[model samples]
Target: MSEDYQLVGSGLTVCEHDAPVEGPVVWLDSPSAVLEFVAAGDVSEKIVLARGGTTTFLTPALTAGVKGVMTLQGAPESHLGILSREYGIPCLMSVAFERGVKSSRGETIPPDGAILRLDVSTHPEGRVFIANGNGHLDVAEPAEVDAEAAAQAEQLRALMASYRGELPKGSAGDRQIRARLRTGVVSTSDENVRRDLAGGEVSDYLSYAGWNLWDLIAARQTEGESGLIPRQEYETVAFVQQWSTYARWYARIVEAIGVDGVIELGSLPRREIGTKVNHVHVWATLCPLFGRAIATELGLEDASARPEDLDALIQFGRRLQHGLWGGGPGFVASRGYAAPVLEASWLERFRDEERRLDDPDELSAFRRFNATTELCGFLLHYDCRAGLCDTGPYPLPDGGFLLVRDHFLHEPGYEWASVIDDLPHCVTEAMFFRPDEDVSIAINDIATTFAQPANYLKHLSGAVVYARDRWDTPVSEVRRLDEAEMARIAHRCDEAMLGLYQRIGDQSVDERIADGVKVYTRDMMMPYARAAGVWDEMVAAGFDELSDLARDAYPALTGGAAQQVLGAVFLMGQGLVPAEGLPPAPEVGPEALPVLHEIAIKGSCPDVDGDAEALEAAGLVVATAAGLMLTEAGHARHDELLAAQRESVDLGRLAAAYERFLAVNGPMKSLSARAGSAGEDERFDLVGQAAELVERVEPALRRTADVLPRFAGYLPRLQEAIRRVEEDDWSYLTSPSVDSVHTVWMECHEDYLQTLGRSREAEGSY
Candidate 1:
């Protein structure tokens, strides 16, 4: 009979079911549809069966007095399911009624207004009874009821209720006890401590503390209010709270497992064990306890989510690029392009050999020089730009590239000199194999971290339980695997290592190339040259002819000031300059101005008694001209550079909108989730937080729209959503409706992707 029914969720009932609840069924496809239906004055008790997976839509429905909820599809432990269990709403997921139920005319089964009965008394899988016609019923069994499991489910429900805030509400005595536990001062008497530990009160306190710790961490990340505790001070407080709480949890564990359990774990000294285990026993016991506590606190639920995995990937990639590709031709080319002096020499060498390549030795020298020169030129021409490219700190062919080039050039007898002949192939090979090898090494490092038998056992135990909880694996069949099986699993996990590397590398390279073109374009360069009145000078004198003179003239404009001048010219071209032109005798920002003024006064206008305005104008012109000729060769290579800059600016603004959304809405969403189990006062406090965060959304959206016109429509919709929430209709925060905050946010997000000419599949959903 149970096999005949589609089981969605199995657990204890959240609320009492003295009798079956029969109600009219309302089938809605989305949160907006539900909102529309409810707002239309349909107040009758009904069971809502939504088509989508998100459970947040139920907030409004529940407020409107829903009898029950059943989703056609959703994970049993999804956020929606968690909310249902917390709200004590009779809920079922993965109903599959679309496939299972059909009418005589072949329509989908359980149409709106169809009467259905849900019986939660059965426990675990509740029974669903449908009234077909003339009072006849079609019964579906969920699962066989388990009494103990039902009891545990009830306890979990109670526990969730208690997690609303710091102190759980109850009789006066219970409140006092909770307060004492929270303060970490549970009666100094040894007998009282022992009794509480034995009675499971210690476990309860630890659970509360753990939840509070997570809440504090979340608050720290999202906190923005001024005059509140400084971030460092808050961190110190959190650290102390964690230490004290974990100590209590560890003490409870020791008490439960007994002295023999501690000794068997080999944490205690044998001599100290007879009387009182000294501080060593406690410290040793705390080590593993601390590890577990930290892991739990950090939410280490997935291997991919672990920081160690990311760190390992970065470390390996860095080593591969620096170790293998370092000092290669590509590296040399990148560096030579950045340094004008080096670039002039490198290009001259390449052109010289090009004319004499008929000889074998000349061909070889030209090949080596050309590869390095091209690589350096490529990086500079395509990857270095103001406000667009992210060319890290060092100029290209970075230190490693330079090292390789130096070795080959200076140490002709070096063994790697032979490798320099085929530098391009060497760099390409390194790029291809780096990620795969790095991933393998990273996985092995992780495996080694669990080399200790106890740690390995813990990891295996966690893996089994995770499988059971998430995948519903039968516990009896989930015994620890042999070494061969474990190795196979590891091998399977690494199957996509190369693909992952390629995907990341390709994305990074594509972005840099796009940025390089946009920032280093002739159109963009024209504005600077025109502003400096160097366009005609550069064209007549020739960039190569003027490069040395410009360098010699602005000898002081090296390091950061050189970069700043380039950036200032780019910004000026983008219309970031003041309307009145140069400010007084001193421009506060962009250090390049003072040096430019000095050079202009000295070289361009050395006569006229140093007239401040004339000198400033002359300095501006000279600076602009100097910037134009500085990287003149790079601009000649690509025509699409200016267009790329525009596209990059658009994408950048869109990205900023998303980042702001996360920063502002992330905390609000967290608070909303907690509000479900919160008491009235706490819920109100959560609402206040949502209001504050929502107020900032409109301005941010407006700012985003100002930068990119395509995003303008989102501002009004977002503003309206915030208005609704602030006006006391709080459901708009997560409402599935079109007017809800989440819906509007997603719409803006979708628009961003569309405008960027990127596909949803390519970007991937959150």
Candidate 2:
């Protein structure tokens, strides 16, 4: 058995003590794989292998269900590694394969289902071993179940089993109806779709139900009539459904910001504001409204605060309502949740027109992400349930219910008119509260009305199809679980989602909710900061800097400060609100060119002698109190010089040098960004990162210097900056106004790109 095993790969261990874990390997290389994972049952014993280092690939529920993780690239500081640590899972990254086999998806890995062992008893280095002939690892252990949580698990299972309601007829037949309905909404005329949808009977019933529930809540009523759910129970279910929706909204927003914001850079950090601000619009307005209502209803203290302290929080509502919306109805189409339900063709035509007008490339910085038009927030429920999709069961006026088995049919709370899938966990967590406790029991206690058949097959089906249609999933490769199997997996997935909710002790539930708000802020904003390349500064300021900003402004949604809102409007009117746009380049005399370039790259320079006077005469450099600085004109002139330099340099040699520079730049950028926030251990690691980066970047610097000798100045400048950084003057690492390591590094990068005739916007590597 021992002879049957062979070492296949090795990587840096994320958490050394958590190594030596063994499980069958399963690769998640595509969206289809993720959907398949959602459909599969008993994945608790499977070790997941992926290529990217981002946590967005796996949903939090899916991550909780897996055994361990391994990646082809990324370090312990990567997002996936951070999540693994939070979950107490073993992770290894940046694996170097000794021998490799390619899978159908074009990823190289151990054969799927092969038992593998990850041993990292050696601390930093971890090894991967695959079973050869025996196909087994002797030390593999079954996952242990916690005794304390088992009782709650049993209660949940029992509750699910108690459902006595009628299920949708014929699983395959139901799926076809749903597929057609979804297709109709996206492609056909809305009139025909609406006619097929029983002339808005579904929406009518949903509205009537919602109104009845609202009225009951207003009356403080809890009793129910025969064959109907109690008003109080409905309220609890509604709260859980809404709570889960908010949580999922937060997660999805983070995913969009973290993943989409950096797509142009391929895992490198860059500041992309379009996605961030767009999401902030929803968070600041509609999300806070719901949060405030929830807090008030629960008698919990409102977490609202003033928003002016956070740079990102200012003027989001004004931007969303006026600036983005001014582009047209299409720009705000996703948020038009209350608009009367239109026919499918009308919606499609509207979408087409919007696409034509909002040429994403030509849009202003605030409108750059015109592609993020997917309906989100409470809008999703309204559009799917009350609008064209009409995912609700209705009385046909003749006989049996017209159960439109569309995208949300099997979702637990959808028939009750909800869209979020994390409701099981939400309900389980909320069960610790009063009305919620009664609501949880009332939901399944009757079996046939609310959240009955508590399965998510249709929800998963719609999600897979959504991915296929919107995200370009390969249609032929898609897979679906059968009804029974889906039901089983749904139960398990819900249990997995309930992990955090299950660990409650005697602590106050209100405090738990508050703590949840804090966690949500840190988790959501950290990724945004990282994607924006401000994680280090934010962390160094005390993660509290970002956290407090999030805590202060987020729950309040602009913090409810009148002055902040008014100031944003004023800034917008003056064309100063979105302040990062670039100005046109300026032309200058050859004599003034280098001086302007020096000031531009170094942030400022000593006026010394008559250089500043000459540049000032040329309307370029300005003599500031600090020193010689580039005016707007000077900066533009420097840009002109940057563009013209390509004609005088060896382009081929410069490109090659830049490629080498990139190999080291990512680690260097990450280290410099983290300098302010590193702990003692992390400080030591950063030192190693700095040394390693210096050694690796040397050849690239030397090659570039061969092409442009002026570039020779960068190496020693970087060395001096690093030397200063070592002496505890940390500002030498990234401060822009000096020959700091990052400053000199970016100067070299800018010069290299300019000499190669490349645009930073086009390359998106900044």
Candidate 3:
């Protein structure tokens, strides 16, 4: 099974998996123990959690204040779902089977890389395909539910039915889901998860079900974060590497600065003036993560001291960071309800994007629950550390215990210490005052709407698709009750599609939106193979709209026409299904390619006369710049693919083309239309650097990093990096740079042409 399936997708990671654990076998009944278990891993393992009955405290962990130590019992956060799943742990919900899960001597697989090993306690040769696959990632094998363990499973299911929250009627479809669980068939019900899906553990309530939510969020927190700007986790980490020389400079900024008086000294973390004097907002956003780091290093008492005490600040400078980037914001309590499962970046959610986008007219669960984004204060005391909570007696700088702030609406209501000349140092402690009730639905609705669904992806059709399936069934990967349930499932997918459209529409031309669209378009295009023949037909379809191309000269369109005439080929050959009459994937006559070109032409370049002429006239290639990063990412990818074929690409030719790309980009560079900040230009340089880096590192990458050995996670980041190359988003590909991912992909394709010793048009790069 491992040989056949490689689970590839984004968020790939490498963790130092040898971290210590309390022990392997755990009692699911103990909530505190479960919290400890979930708390154990950071970039590596999530406790191999499984359960059948009575996970009472798990709900609380999910609901615990976003800022504190809490965990979920039934499921850790959704992100951990992939970890538990990919690592081969089975979760069953009934004591009859659940209690009988382990032997004192069972083995556990480490959650590093893409490999997973299954260990059987009593039954060694049981099926291991339950959780393996690119699609259907959430399916779990119930040893009891199998024909071999049906009796035990039934007893367990019956017991689970009797134990907790009674199953709701008209809630969702679960039968089709259950049917597939026993067998390997996936119906439409298996696909989506949205709000309609009745059973998402609210982002906050996991603690109630008895798991530690804090450790879960902590694991979610990404390090190497600098300042309060919202940047993608991967981007920020890479960005910080570029800024490594300024560690102490920023640290000094922290030392000399106070929450008041805003004259922005640096261009890096920019400040706006007037009604937009949003500096206060930036400072507060940074406070949470900085506070956590300080508290972790020096006890909270020293950290809580006002800016003047200099003790915590002193503690800060001594911490030898591996690079300039370190902490930024803290646990941002999201309103990520069941709208569509959204992933909270351990970084971005806490950055000041919230204050920037904040509209006074809008209603939000965050504001409803409390007036601001910070949440630990509401969940954890009037002085939470005082008599209420049991964790510590950590000392303060002023010879007193640090107290929790009672009001989440503002910082601790303490006096500010005058740094230069105060007699006594002042300290401000944080507190949370969440009432003893459930705040899940309110919070989730707000955050979910704003969140980029599934870790930085906005309006992810994939998540919505998955959510609808879960919505149809309370438990995952089970079938729908019937056909009507299936219709509802499809409707939900459409609805989610609409929601995504609304979100995407909001960012019609934004870079995150544009890049995400291309990312999605490419992913969505995957199921349908992109043969060159397909492109020619697309152009023909849109041919009449393109004034530059005369229709008859091309005659009927060919797949190449689709490529030449239209920039994109969307839904081409969709008619193949009905026209596919008999046997072997239907040979749609030679005429098919031309039709595809027409369709593509109609779809993409119907009126490129505007942007194309305007930009080309300006000696700038906006379209080309738009695609550089994506293209370069592609170039690296094709090179990897070519190497795997025992046909190494010509590095010298690629380097030559890269140089050409640079020459054409001058004058032709569309400096005005580029995506990011003035600094983003520098960041874009990172893409160009990556292109050059891939060229430089190709030999090593081929030797050490090429692991076509796994599927899915393998080479998926290349998906982004690939598009960067293909699109010539680097500005090199558009005008003169021979180095383009499209050029690279094509050149690498030409290398394959060389390998096969076949003549291909790509050989002569015009």
Candidate 4:
């Protein structure tokens, strides 16, 4: 039997031991195959070797009766390896398995029902032997196996003993933090909360859900035992030290700045605003520690900090830290919860595909683009430092970035290469800045140009009114606000809004445009840009477009009409009654009269044919302005128009159109992927297909815009991307740098979820 066997494949061991296990070889090709084999009771006492890389669906089989797992593809940090380590399952990845092999004597080797022996103790390379007989004697003795397990258990005991005694030392605040961790509030059950902790050994609590510190240490000692390398072990140690140091700094800053001061600094009413500002405060406090982390990661030495450049260093460092921790799995998971309708709908499709074995394309595609995967990929590409800041330095569960360029290189379609290349590079360079740059002065200058009182007022009033209107029950119950008090708050918001318009006249269109770009880019869009790896380029392009539009459309916005229209549009989008209210007459001077008339005729403004006093008496008009102000009657008319427009929208039709759009859009991957190293003609052909799909969905999107005008911007943006694609500017095809096709599609989907008042978690299939 031994003579009949032949050599097959070799790979690195995931769980190291001197013992060997022999079992019948079971070859599985896909997730469904694994499931089928388990259901059929064929997995018992078998060595399961599967094709393809790590997938979430394979988890069930891995946990079943299989003796071990050998995969054609998987990395040390891949989901398979992670699970294997967690479950104490012996595994090998990147295995080369031979089928229908013949021996040197031209005899069939290891025929059907072959017994496979997997010996993993050999360092660097493991061995796989196959024998023709069902029983092979290469398996380790039972006593030896038991002894090896006992040794591992003893090692773990010693490691845990050491870890438990090493209490963190720090100031009072730091002690308080450590006390909280010891009290169990920061344990595995509270992984969500612990994930948000800025810096601390508290992060280790994530591993408590599965493996412990003992496992980590033992794995490190055994080298390849835990599917991690020596460098990874060193980094893990560094991470713990860095986190503790930063935690101390964070504690000191909180003590110095006071919790109230930090809260006050993040005055915005939004929950995310408070959270992000708190993160910023932490970064600011621990600037030096973060600088060192950046320097260490970038292979830089400790340099002298110039007083003049300190602020810039701090700002750049803050941005870097934010990029690292912000917009990670926790953030994206929160988005999933908030937008449950979208999440549920997308996931339903994914599940449907998962159920079908005959067609795995959709399942594979969905897995690649699912929200969690996308978020992880985003972190890898943008937040983690790897591959020109375009490719993902895939994040590990332990707050470390895993360099996984080789994994992408071997990915099935090679589309990820194009995806990586398309990402912007320079934006992440902020994290690696030298000590002398005057980044602070530039940041301050930009902030000054962008700070507009009107924009702030707009956001504040919008938030206040939106809360009061949409959350009336909760607000009234919580605040015990009577109608009179609620009315007072509303009036105050209106007054503030009125003040904003009055100040709008102080700045010219050019100035407003510049300031708007700064505010929108830095304050509103920067977070998204950082996560998407398109910060500088996207902001510049978006602002450039805004500037061009303002210049070209100057005539239509004269005589303070721009501000009025803007306020109207803003309020309407928020689902709040326009404060300026629609007016019936010429509120503009002679030069702008034609523009105002044109607007009214276009049904963009209300037309007043009756007496103003009668309209007010009827409660149709409350107060008249030099500009449009809607009385009760005018407000009703406006609502009627909106209602009519909304009535035109068929949700079912729109949903189907969207589904069709995704079906066509999903396969295109990226512009370069479609081009496929082919000639320009092939690229143009692919572009035409995408453009045609865009055209197909235009009518549905237009109808959607009628109901929710916020969606109106998406159609134009999609058209622009298509136009750019047609002009051979392929970057716009799927580029996140600007209003690319994919970006606009995603925004449109978000609008649909919002307008329909649907949660991503609960929504039905599209």
Candidate 5:
């Protein structure tokens, strides 16, 4: 057939199959468009185009209904890519149009009602052709789920539905814990919130924490506090019900997957889970010994001045009598599920009737983990810091541990949390370092040291865990530390903490720390403070150290101000930051174009007064209450520079780099997703994967940087993030607020796309 058609555009095909599909392009650029399209019904011939890969949530209802999907952004690693693959839909990502008429949606497209054909026979690249023929293609029916898989799914769902446990009561302690969890939730972006929504049962972990805390709080009180007490009581019952639900779900998974699955699941990662469980467990196991210690410390033995507080404290011992056995949150959150499940033949080896503190193994492991565990007192802002003092029977070369008994709550800290001191020399050495000889740091949330020292010696400087490696190391070994040995270990811990801040000098460290702090403040603390009704008080207190932290987070702006400037610039780039009653933008010429480029990249031309003035004079930037933000003209100018920059790039070489990048991209993303729910040991392994990924992608990044020097910044940034992970600052792995490994990796990916003059939509990444 001599078909008369034009090759107008092409994209990366999501699926590797041969199927040609034809449909009219329907741009779903907004939520209303999605709603309207879904309402239209029977959209079997409409191929929907969206700007982002994450638009899957919006299009889930439309996915089965549509003929095909063509996204402007996102790669095969994207959620939409995964969904389309699952549905066996013909999807193309990052389509680039060579020539086309502008549509009402502001993107180039073929004429209205024009039929476009997607030829996806090729492995990677899919071709687009405009052919003169009636648009008729048979819609493929949805695939049927396998009978066994369907039954398994049903079984899981049934377990989820059968929970009817009692809820725990609420207290001031519960409120404190909730505040921290809420901060984490509120600090995240809207995009992440949507991801959590898509995550289904996994997101319910937060709910379990909330309800369980309330129960604990209520249990602490001697008598109910009327309205508050009743509410706590109801919430406690609901909490127990949720706990029951989670327990059933976990137990069923264990039963189906067996002991192997249980080992993979490991312990829960949340600090709060361990803290809450340890509190109840320790009180239950050694209340007489610990209760007397606490009474003496709080001076409550005589019960003179604070008899009510003492009585309430004593009530906790009785209220939380159920020892930290198999029914706590840890059971539901962990792999073993509950004690009953442990009795199964496959898991019988894991069962321990001597699981309480009296058992040496249980006691040792508990101290190793919970020594630094802390909590805010009943209603106080400062930490109660009531956890065990230190973790070790850590043996020295002379067969003694360099243990410090005092400050146990904070002494051993994160540095020794996961250290397996008693492992065989060879096994411990293998666990301490990666195969390539990089020191393998353990996963501990409390360790916040970021970046490695520039002139550094590599060694196992912090806690290290072998989560996957099965080992039995008795905690009963008693060791003594000479003064010299004790001092040596203490020095090592100090060195571990000292990194970029000291090595690179305060300015760069200050700025870098500020960047992380800025993200933490804006995304997490501010939202939390506001939610907790303490924002005003914080502001009144002059932001204290927060002001110092935020001030240097971003690159310094011109006019001697940088407060909220990055946020302002980000908003302006998006065409909004909640502006009102602005003055009209001024007109300018090519004279200010260079200055515009500088301001665009550096955020501000602080050193050059003329450059700053040129940008403002060109109406490219506007001053606001926060700081200087880019104007519409500024964004247009920046885009122009970007286009010009792309013209000089070696497209072939950059494309090669992108292909290489794609090789490691999916693995990194998958690792990150898994790390979200994985235990500390598993996360440590994931970090090892991340380090390997960084090495693998370095050459690709170098090739791109050779073409565009600006691209060079990514490698070091990524390395620094991974290095932070090595030092036990786990947030550097994926935290959006900071220049984390994932963040830098993605930025580098986008830079490559931009340099090659490709739209993220066409590339299928957003």
Candidate 6:
């Protein structure tokens, strides 16, 4: 990296819109944004003022005199890449720009530094120029661009100007949200779109409301709108996102109130008769994961009794992320999962029962989660006004995943017809809030909340029976450990899990050893099972690959009732099912860079209909079996999807992917030169080769944006798991390895990236 790079500027500035309040400056985090910037019709050939260090592609902009009329806003290393490879330009981030801008106009640079003189090559039409390595900048000569491109860029710039005003201040975020909300012509400069893509209250509401509403809006405008992410769909993601908005706020409220902030909810003004509720309802109906003794003691149900009872409930609340909302095994007789029908002969009734609601497996949990999420939505609406949910997406970094299955999750909304279960609104409303104000608790609060000794004894009762198939240890022996170390281990494991869960739920969970175990148990083994199953099933026709792990896992554990205990452990692990298969990228091959990028664009998964073929046909490459099969027309469908998005991105994800692409291609001088020739465009030429370069990367870029964060997000969690394994605590591991968050998050994300044009072959790793 050099200390000095200079840009010489003529007196000129060009962009379709009025100047941004701070004076518009380019901040390139992604190559896609670079492409978009050139395609925006905002650059002028007359000015060549470089503001920062140079980078590979940006050099020509300076050399062609489009460089540094104003300011450049990136780093020196990045700037240098754009410099020596092309012509030099002055950029503001440069020390020279600062000294020059601060000093007078007629300043001369010291002879020791690299200095560029200014020149002009203006076009009659208002077209911006960007370069391609093919001796043509992405910017085209005036005649090469089309009217539609110019008009669309203008339209987007207008929208961008408006987006800039939406943010009251600072960055606006709420998961994979802003991208979903983007609609209509996109601003050429993703920076411009980013400047405008902020929302305060409206975004807050939509965060809870779900992307479904956006889909709903678009659905109304379109013909075939059946496939959309329903806000109320029966999926864990919807459930998580629903409360995330509140969780974000609740975290703030806690900071504002205290660790005991939830208690204040009980004292709030009673809701009007018709007002929608928060989670208080579901909190009421669901059995506490811990049990009644604790719930009653916490002023949860207004019960007064013994010290044991008080200790029990407190333990339950403290143990689970959701405490005793649903009673544990003790209540299982009448409060937990089987509570609704334990003695009612529901299981027996299944033998002869006709097809009906409550099939036990499908709708139950899914229904419960969505019902609660929607309730949380209404509750959050009140909280925002009432002074509870305050911090933005709560801003904590604790992240995880949830599952979404079509036949299982989809259901009619409250406003739609329901052919599904006819459960009363009371049960549905139960999702509002669990018993105590502590929403950060877990459903696994099965320790103190169960009927205590009684529930423990009962669960063991069946344990004795199932132990008959064990690997030599008597059921009585394993059950002995339950009594001997049950509560003690329960306490230790409780502390660890609770610590992990709270951090994760609040998104404030540290990426430390404690959370690492969570990632491993949750991410690795689980995902291993998932990917194994999918790979096996797809590779063969048998779904039996899952059976081996199921068998091997229990026998491997030490204990008599080990199977039963393991089953329970598995259930606890079940909550993070979708994330089970996450694994870091396999291995990508460097020489296969273009193919890798194409694979990343067009998914490697058979289920995907990504941009592989399309990007290839559009001058990219597809080096995978799945990609080669897609027709050019099929690829166009991929283009249509990307073009239809209505949101803005920092383009950081795309940059990472492209950077990965660059790394693979860095050595291939031939391809790099070819890439240089056609990739960068100068003037806004929507239909010509210049436009084609932008077009080739846009969908791939969007896909890069869509999936990478999900991948990037898993790193801290993964590192934490590595730390945990080193500690060797036999406690339940929730991390991505062996079974952790990072594992699945990585796999799922990598899988998506592979579908895009980025292939593993090019990167030299999967």
Best model number under TM-score: 2
Candidate 1: regions farther than 4 A off: 1-16, 42-44, 96-108, 134-766
lDDT of each: 0.35, 0.42, 0.23, 0.36, 0.40, 0.26
Clash counts for all predictions: 15, 5, 137, 24, 29, 157
The parts of candidate 5 lying over 4 Å away from their true place are 1-4, 133-266, 269-766
**Model 2 steric clash pairs:** 164-447, 165-448, 190-343, 190-344, 190-345
- In candidate 4, position 418 carries an lDDT of 34
Pick the winner on lDDT between candidates 3 and 4: 4
Off-target runs (Cα >4 Å) in candidate 6 are: 1-175, 178-212, 215-596, 600-766
State which candidate, 4 or 5, has the greater lDDT.
Answer: 5
lDDT of 1 by residue, 604-681 (tens): 332233333322222222223233211122122121332343555656766777667656756655765675576666
Best by lDDT: 2
For model 2, the superposed segments whose C-alpha errors exceed 4 Å read 1-6, 10-21, 27-45, 50-65, 71-82, 92-107, 112-115, 119-127, 131-279, 282-493, 496-583, 586-766
For candidate 3, lDDT tens digit of each residue in 396-481? 23232211111111111111111112110111111112222322221120111111121111111110001112111222232212
Of candidate 1, the 10-residue stretch with the lowest lDDT total is 441-450
Number of the candidate with higher TM-score, 4 or 6:
4
The CA lDDT at 472 in model 1 is 19
Q: Each prediction's TM-score against the native? A: 0.20, 0.26, 0.19, 0.24, 0.24, 0.16
Model 2 vs. true fold: TM: 0.26
Full-model lDDT, candidate 6: 0.26
What are the RMSDs of all candidates, in order?
Answer: 35.1, 28.6, 30.8, 31.7, 29.3, 32.8
